[model samples]
Target chain A: MNPIPMEQSLMVAAMLFSLGLIGLLVRRNVIFMLISIEIMLNAAGLAFVVAGSHWQAADGQVMFLFIITMAAAEVAIGLALVLRLQSDLPTLDVDAMDQLKGGDDA
Target chain B: MFWLTSIVAIVATLLAISRLNATHALLYLIVSFLSVAVLFLQLGAPFVAAIEVIVYAGAIMVLFVFVIMLLNLGPHAVEGERQLLPPHAWIGPGLLAAVLLLELLMPLSNNQFIPTTGTAKHADHSTIPTIPTEAAPQLQERMVVGPKEVGIKLFSTYLLAVELAGFLLLAGLVGAFHIGREEPRTSAKPGAMEVPSQEGPA
Candidate 1:
């Protein structure tokens, strides 16, 4: 079987990244926003793997390992913030958490 | 095989993002991760494929599920999600993403964007013996990068990065603990004054 074209793999990654962007823009919930971020990170990892395969280098996978580590850390802190927000507020909607959106009148 | 798995991953991710219930979305996300693992395998990164399944699909997803359960999201949460996600809410982002996808695909389809190598070339000093050069060179043109190469390169070239990642994880652990800690009760009970009086006698 012929190897999958690099361009095709990259195209897949791009599509996934775009889907992630759409999710991030549309989702109001904090958890969903985190999920969208994960999708975007994964898409980036996929692109790295594709590039690594094209070069036959392990650097791409190594970069992917770092991305996963970062994702894990981000999720840990993000979920904790989610819990904190849940305790302080009644809703998880990002738009509703506008306490920091101060006005000059304050 | 690659195209099929890509389609599966894409569809699963779309469903994941669209689901109202968090758990349902997570399940689809797991499916998406698993299919992406298969894609990694097809790309000749077995170690990466394994890590994708173990770390991404297994450990990370379990963490997500645990948080969702701890949040105790109920049917009402789903109802709220539905109300928040009106049809018009999706239209703008969907159009933007569609335009992004079109732009991405157009350049990719162009002949000038194709890679010169077309496929991966095997390294001369490769440690893996599975490549049968005499039997079928054409079938195994792409190099199969295993764990050994990845480990060597990681420790030698990216040692500082690994250390930094560890530090980042430690920071994340501390930050999570601090942020998630329960606050002390602000209101004092009537018996609070009696406790100090009893301690003074003792």
Candidate 2:
């Protein structure tokens, strides 16, 4: 049997997820927002691993592998977009990319 | 041991998200990932723990650092980050996250919600014996789900998902290449003048 209870382990994942959510909501930098999204994905992976351990199943780890794969792909595209954005814009501030915010009217 | 690592992960993650410098935040995030890998180890998912360290702390973080360096963010950028994140900026999100955390924890704290321990479905599968430690006597005879079983499951049950993941990665690679490539200056813009000056030298 594992020493720590499953609930407590899940609580840790929850806290991490919440922190990531806060980061996502507060940070204006696109890179920081991407980092926050990574944190959230990691937290979700933690929860899956914990549940797998609870049931003594390998399915959780399989899911985690998928998560890691998805995160890798996402980071690749996101960083590429960031590079493109940096080349076009003077600043990395997300608010600066407001060309689509307003309608056709001035 | 588990609690210690969990605390470290949480604290490191908190510090990571609040940093003004991108590189500094990435470093803290690495530390946080390492701590979580330790947690994965304690949970008996050694395979996952190793991947966590190798991919998260090693590969992904290196990618982040490379991008930050390529961007060459100066002190002015750090100053801009500070302006973007004032002391007052944290209040609303912090409160919202706190409330979400409370909601997640309230049920977990209740005794009635604790899951009952039962025999594992794969109890017959081979498990590596763990050495008894003074700190965690209960983990002495715990079942360790090693990489062998995970590999079997991946190939047998999750083969389709693996193929899909590979396809997704390929698509991402092509997309990133197209998006990241420098565009030719064919448009009638100010930068179009510079294109001929570079070609004249050749």
DockQ of 1: 0.32
DockQ score of candidate 2?
A: 0.37
Give the lDDT of residue A84 in candidate 1: 61
The residue ranges of model 2 lying beyond 4 angstroms of the native Cα positions read: A100-106, B73-126, B129-140, B186-202
lDDT of 2 by residue, B1-202 (tens): 5676687788879988998877667867887887787678667787888899899888888888777766764546667657645676555435434443453345335421122111122333444432223323344445556777788999999999999999999998999898777667523232222222221110
Which tens-of-lDDT digit does each residue in A1-106 have in candidate 2?
A: 3356899999999999999999999999999999999999999999999999888899999999999999998998999888766655556788877764121123
Q: Give the least accurate 10-residue stretch of model 1 chain B, judged by summed lDDT.
A: B193-202
Off by over 4 Å in 1: A101-106, B73-127, B130-139, B186-202
Per-residue alpha-carbon lDDT of model 1 for A1-106, expressed as tens digits? 3677999999999999999999999999998998999999999999999999889899999999999999998998999888766654556788767755211112
Going through the candidates in the order shown, the clash numbers are 0, 0
- iRMSD, all candidates: 9.6, 7.0
TM-score of each model, in listed order:
0.75, 0.74
Model 2: colliding residue pairs: none
